[model samples]
Target: MNDSGAVLPWLVIRQDDNGNRYRVGRYATRAEAQKMADSLDARGHKQLYWVERIGQSVQ
Candidate 1:
């Protein structure tokens, strides 16, 4: 959970050349989510990968 008490608050996102975005996965920590995004980016695919934090935690 993040400091905001959100579970799996980090999200790995993938965006293709067509500008379509997809949610790759969610993680408890930003590092974990960034790892997944970096790993995917290393593949050298046309798609772009990145991470973002969830703005609100579900109660």
Candidate 2:
């Protein structure tokens, strides 16, 4: 949650190769999330997906 009462969404990255997912970190902006994903991709983790967190959302 931020200064507003609404729940803030998260930017998540998952490793597609092994069906394992990990939270790179939480961000209030999509750009921050993309940046993190790109950083991971540059590090050779190409099999990754970026997703947003929604209300009552399930992985």
**Which candidate number would show the highest lDDT if scored against the true structure?**
1
Once all C-alphas are superposed, what RMSD does model 1 give against the true structure? 6.2
Candidate 1 wrong stretches, greater than 4 Å: 1-6, 56-59
Each model's lDDT comes to 0.85, 0.67
Tens digits of per-residue lDDT, candidate 1, 1-49, equal 6578868978888888998888899898999998899999999898988
lDDT of 1 at 52: 86
Model 2 stretches with alpha carbons more than 4 Å out: 2-8, 56-59
Top candidate on TM-score is 1
Please give, for residues 1-59, the per-residue lDDT of candidate 2 as tens digits: 76776554766666677787776677777777777777777777558767576453345
Give the per-residue Cα lDDT of candidate 1 at 57: 30
Candidate 1 is scored at a TM of 0.80
Q: For every candidate structure, what is the RMSD over all alpha carbons to the true structure, in angstroms?
A: 6.2, 3.7
